[model samples]
Target: MTDTNRTCFMKGQGAQPRRDRSQLPPRKMATLIIVLTMLFFLAAAHNAAAQPQKPQPERPLVFVPGILGSRLVDDNGTVIWGDRNSYLNFPKLEIAPSGPVTALHSDGRLVESINVLGPFWTIHQYDTLLHYLHSLGYIDNETLFVFAYDWRLSNFETAKQLQTFVDDPKRGRLQNGQFDLLSHSMGGIVSKLWMVKEGGAARVHKAIYMGTPFQGSMNAFETLSDGWGDFTNFIAGGLPTVRRVALSFPALYELLPTYDKCCRLGSPEKYTPLDVLDVATWRQRDWLPSEYRANGPRGAAFERGLSEARRVGELMRQPIPGVAQVMIAGDYFDTGLYLYVPTNRQSWRDWNFRRSKGDGTVPVWSAANNFSSIEGTEPSFQQHATIFADKYLQNKLERELLNTAPPPVKHDVLGEIDTPKHEKRRLDLARADLSPRIAEPGANATVTVAFEFETGVTRGDVQPTAQLLQRGAADAPITLVETTTDADLAVRRLTFAGSLVAPAVEDTYRIDINVAGQGDHAVFLTVLSAGRRQP
Candidate 1:
């Protein structure tokens, strides 16, 4: 054996390849083994890193209720239950980031029913909505943070408290998307104050205002006994408390910095009363340029309110901002209706001031941010959705009204107005009526009618109907297909077939069509013709 092999032989053990280093020093070998082990581990880790990581789930949603309103109900009719001091309690919506959060925020304690109820006529009715949404499986694994503040307090004070909650140092570490806010009436104002003035906007993703009094309500001033206006001297002229309130449009306009030419004087009636309560009343009020803008001391109050509103708005203005705003408005139900009178003081009392589909306080125009002078009919169909307590729908409607919805408005922003955009929007054509304009010259011709159905929330098979109205001639007669059966919707392709009399030529040949919703849906209609058209 060679010298190396001889050393191995002398040890009485066959020598392994020196390249293998089986006979290496213990510490060196151990160190080499350790290095190889680490290398293996590092390689394994790198390979593992090459694979894709699992996707994280969506963050939970947050629900912020409007004002100090509670979502509870009690036998006593108090919307909020009171503690020993008659203090109020509220409910909240709690959705876990990974599970369902079904708690509603209350101004006070949310557990007891004794302090709930009585605030609004629709308290319990509204709570039923929460139960319904829960049944729909919307509250799962979501963290719903319900915030409550004393809205009865000044807006500045309430806003500060909300700001602190959003700015809490621990808040930054929490993993979640922005909260979705749903507010109503005074709650809307409170939210605006918080989001804009208090920097809550940074944390909010969306806000929905329902029947908020962005502009002062005439009803507020009207509620004062007729003599209350006479006390302008007492409490420093109309009570500084009342004068400084930003509830009404006249008051709010004073807070905003940007008042249009109409607001330059004081009264908003000059350009348009779109933001004010009872917009129709302006039609009857004699208006002039001088009455439009603020001028004197009374105007000073107007300037104050306008400035505040503007300041609140300024906080919201940002490039690619985080928050979305929406407003939902209701038209007064009895606007044009007549009322009966009981006595002189009640001279034809028209409580018709209340909105038909609204919360009895907010008028459609005033509730919506119509002050932008955007020329279009506001959507009047939101009442249908509000009947259900889906805060999402409410939020959408409110945002659309405020023109603060996401890039594209999903809510029914156009009530009955026929704008170009509205015209282009696809209608769920549920039914159609195809009728011949003229009996024809006995030439082979036909009219075809087709019907279909569609829905925004559901994707399923749909069926519709087609109805026909035939007017033989002006002096001849008119016949409407009066049938209560679904068969009345059958498609008709009228052609000059056997024994089919050609349409008679007379002074006028026409067909009228009327489409109605069927089943559990409202259907839109579209008609097309293959024969001579009628004017």
Candidate 2:
């Protein structure tokens, strides 16, 4: 059968048992009327469950977390804010331990702390994104479902688990009664692999991927090596060969080839098909991996994954069927300066680039489908700040998703420019200026900036955009100022006007301007003097 027909069939199957509230018996209706009359109620309750409720407010928001869905777990082994079968569930939150509970690895080892599992929302702690979204007014309580799963399982196995949970008769029902997926990084690949391999895609309505290396990551090889021990520890926490292969880098890369042969063919025995709504490319601090000097040297497998990721990228150049993909470029760098650590060997010199937004991990060009979409916005500067705790970043991202804004078009207008001569500069300039005189509380300041593109850059060649930020003042929540548009692909002039309210005091104010399109372009940014105000 056709993929479209299959999707329709699956949705119909899941939506069958809903009761018809409109077809009540005359006696039953009389009883209901009496109950409402006694309470002085004037309107009858609509049977939304029976009559295909709209996909809004209570829209299905499936959270496909990275790694082993550890973030959805609680101290008492409850699946807090996740699928029923997850390590923790919302109901279990009441009995879970509180006040500094340590997580026990699958192997029975107690971890004092795991930095990999962020402190605010660690592998064992849950609901950072959901809470942030709530504060942003994006979603109401109980509107999101965290699909937490063990990452140490093979793609095939992971797909099976997801399929079972989604296809379950009692669980997995949306307002409209269809599954929605939002997977990050490896989770995206696994979700797709399952849809095409294990026959799960037939049930999905939308699949949104954030910063997923659908093409693969060049650093995957190195990361996989380092992660082997961690994966071993996580997979029931042991060095079992079966567990090792599940997180194996080479094995993950081979999934594409395996599926192309199996399902892409025209056959009754083929797996389900993919119907993705949006694919978002997200990158923040720690997006890139540090090259470890300890690993005897890179291996052939690492090189192979890098090569394959690049190849996959080439394959994704064209759009897929029933799928519309958009790219999001974040240029809010907040990491420290690059601290160069030289190798101990006197004869050999290798440096450790310790800094925020390093190019090695996720370069700005690689973060989105088309960098030109955000010509003037700077990704390097965006990489400086991490969104681990910023409510503005958290809410803003969800807003973008809920709005369903199309990916920046090739000729989309970014914004206009107006700056003073004092902030202008020539080509070959490395650093720009952020005027201290314009100091304002991040939450209540109006910012205006000017940029001088090098002579080599033409107005039509590369689209340059600007980002204005207010750093943390004392201790206040970071707030994002209102703006005209999410991207600026065409700006022509010496000065630019970037008007937005300063973020909350928690964010330090700064200015970043990046060239998003083609051609060799260089520019300098200067924050025009402005008064700071408390709102």
1-535: candidate 2 lDDT, tens digit per residue: 9977877787888855445677898899899989979666323344443575322333456666554344344457543333323221212221111211223222211221222211111222225555554554444324565555644334555667777756555453443455556665556666666666665555565666554444333333333334333322342233232223322333344322111211111123432321110111101111122221123132333344334543444443444444333332332222122222222321111212222222223323334434334353223222211222232333334544453433333431122122232232232212223323233344233333333333423333323455543333342222222222213213322333334444433222334455332111111122222331211
lDDT of 2: 0.36
lDDT of 1 by residue, 261-284 (tens): 211212223322123222222223
TM-score each candidate.
Answer: 0.38, 0.40
Query: In model 2, how many backbone clashes occur?
Result: 46
Per-candidate local distance difference test: 0.36, 0.36
TM-score of 2: 0.40
Span of 10 residues, lowest total lDDT, candidate 2: 275-284
Q: For each candidate, C-alpha RMSD in Å?
A: 19.9, 21.4
What is the lDDT, from 0 to 100, of the residue 127 in candidate 1?
53
